[model samples]
Target: MDSTATGMRTHEIFIDGVRQVFHVAGTGPVCVAHSGGPGIAWEYLRVPSLEQRLTMVYLEPVGTGNSGRLDDPRDYRLDAYARFLHGVVEHLGAEKVFLLGHSHGGFVAQRYALDHPDRVAGLILFATSPVTGEEFWNSAMAEVARFPERHPGRPEAAGMPDAFQEALAAGTDEDYTTALRRILPLYFADYWAHEELAPMRAGLLAWIDPMRGEEPAPFDVRDALASIAIPTLAITGAHDFICGPRWSRMLHEGIPGSRLIVLPGSGHMCHLEEPEAFTLAVADFTRASVPGAR
Candidate 1:
């Protein structure tokens, strides 16, 4: 567990009486990681490989994990999330930091970077997109539809149409994770191959009391991408049903000089499918992007 790791303290701040918490772990250059799910625990994105090289700061997004919940669903908007994160970063006393956002976290990351590009030294967007509307979801569903063509005999994907929605409506966190497990086979190119370690890792994740918040607001930041001048890297799994290569290309192309990497034979969980590669890619980008970080 590396309890001895430097700066392993968990810090907290109050936002409208709800405590927003962040855990600092490992050592060396600091890279703040925002997990996906918008409602997930930050521990879900823990990359031990990146932790080996960089001090990973895991931010518990508002209304999730140890963070406080909001009574208004509108408070779940990107701007509000960005403001909360900015407050956390300021509390850390860091002049600049590398930012990593995964899936839903990517939404908040883009928002934070747009609102405070100067505070960001580099950006890592993984398994994410610039927008989440009818088109984005349709594209993902289409990918799931083609799963049988690539993975013959995996008929469970047929029910994926209702998988996410059921999970959302399931309410309880345990029910949500259980529902997600059903669609997880669609998230990895070789699910059984990594199932042993992956499930163990999931068990290690930390969750807070039931998350109380409104449905996440739709995101649209394609035009705003032009203003993000920091070094940016967008990586996605080729088979990522949710945030696939199309959006990865959008970020790579929209952000000037931004680089994109597509992992073959993988799905939404590319970091777990190929952790070593994921780790190195991030290490390489942060080194080149952040001054003196190399």
Candidate 2:
């Protein structure tokens, strides 16, 4: 598999009446993974090194990005999503594929791995959590609090959680875009000083529009974690406001044979903040778990 810029192929696949857009890069054992939100497209997560090491299959779930939208919101549940992913892997004729997920995507991946452990070769969970509890939400908001002091809209944004939720519930593209623009910076405050995150920032806003008014369903994968026997890598950024190190620690403790890696001075988007370190960690973990690799 070659992860070089010129060797990738992008295409769309239809399953159960939904079209999923994906990019295939390199040529080796397959690694089929999705992005977070249950609505976010995979475009924002492009790991070139992983693509080079394995035939990376980045899938945009149904109703996201270039994929076809579904009329029923019931189809958005984690169980349905995991079944859809299984069909995708089987459709691709991959008997043993690696699974890597980021943020909310990791939640999806966790469920899928537990449901079909025999089909999975390995698991990579980057800045993901099994569940979003009150403590986690409060901690995330506290992280957001740090920036209000220097941020331009500090006064207006302070204690504006109701306003933010109202904007999201407005169910208009413009409303979603406005709220995302105002809130996204808090997720990456630690890395804003040195890195250019314009692409991720823009993509996130675009991805949030269709998801407006769609409540995030509760996901409890604690029991599933114990059932996951495959080697797993759990990576988190120390400063992650979205899903913090505590989430990663919980995953590491619950999932058997899982290792945890926390990158210093990084946030939710650790891959972007510390690409070199992130890539190296993934490459080492993947190689170690690949079938027949010593």
Candidate 3:
């Protein structure tokens, strides 16, 4: 497969009789990237820094991106998605991969590593948590309150917790875009500074999810994390509304020998707001995790 600086090849594979699509960019060892959203497109997790250094297999996820959607919505459950992730590695004929998962995708990645510890060379987790449920919504409420009272969407931001689901239920591009705009302030440490443009761009590319993580009720993976034998790096923003530095700390502590990095004055969108720092953190982790590094 010929890949230029900007060229990529999209490939399709069948898992449980359903066709799933993923993109391949660069060469050398594989680092499979699972985008957040659970249903959002893969573009959000696109890290240009890691693309060429390590061939990244950009997973579109089971029901998002160029991948095929599932008929039985229950299949969207986290465990099922984790199973799909395992299948992807086999489909690619790789023995092991350095995995990157953000937000919901982080949940799936952890589940995969928990179930198949030997298959992962190392893990790079961003803006994710061991437990996700009502607490996620509650913490989000507190975080949004920090925003200025005069912010454009302050009044409507009360419903930001439900905005993603509302947009999902509505299933209209316009509604999705509006919900994306309304809830934009909640995701940034300093919303007015970045303004609506960033979240709006993300929302336009994002999609819907049939099963929210809150479903089947909240569950925590901290107990199982102790058994993971891979070097893991957890990255989070100090101001991340949903999964703040504390959550990242918990992730680091639960996984034996894991490292955590926090980006100051950033929120959920730090990958966008602090791209250079975020990218370099992952790059450093990858290099340092190697057998020898000075």
How high is each candidate's TM-score?
0.88, 0.85, 0.87
The candidate 1 region of ten consecutive residues with least summed lDDT is 205-214
- The root-mean-square deviation over C-alpha atoms between each candidate and the true structure, in angstroms, is 3.1, 3.6, 3.2
Per-residue lDDT tens digits for candidate 2, residues 99-141, read 8888877877888888899989889998999877677667766
Native-to-model Cα distance after best TM-score fit, residue 157 in candidate 3, in Å: 7.4
**What is residue 150's positional error in candidate 3, in angstroms?**
9.4
RMSD of 1: 3.1
Q: Count the backbone clashes (under 3 Å) in each candidate.
A: 0, 2, 0
Query: Model 1, range 1-294, lDDT digits (tens) per residue?
Result: 234555467888886576888888777778888887757667667787787888888888887766777776556766777788888888778888888999888888898998899898889999999887888878776876676677666566557656856755776667766766666677777676674656644554333224332235557889888888889999999878888899999999999999999989678878888888888888998888766755
Model 3: clashing residue pairs? none
Output the number of the TM-score-best candidate: 1
Count of clashing pairs, candidate 2: 2
| Candidate 3 global TM-score | 0.87
Rank ordering of all candidates by lDDT, starting from the highest: 1, 3, 2
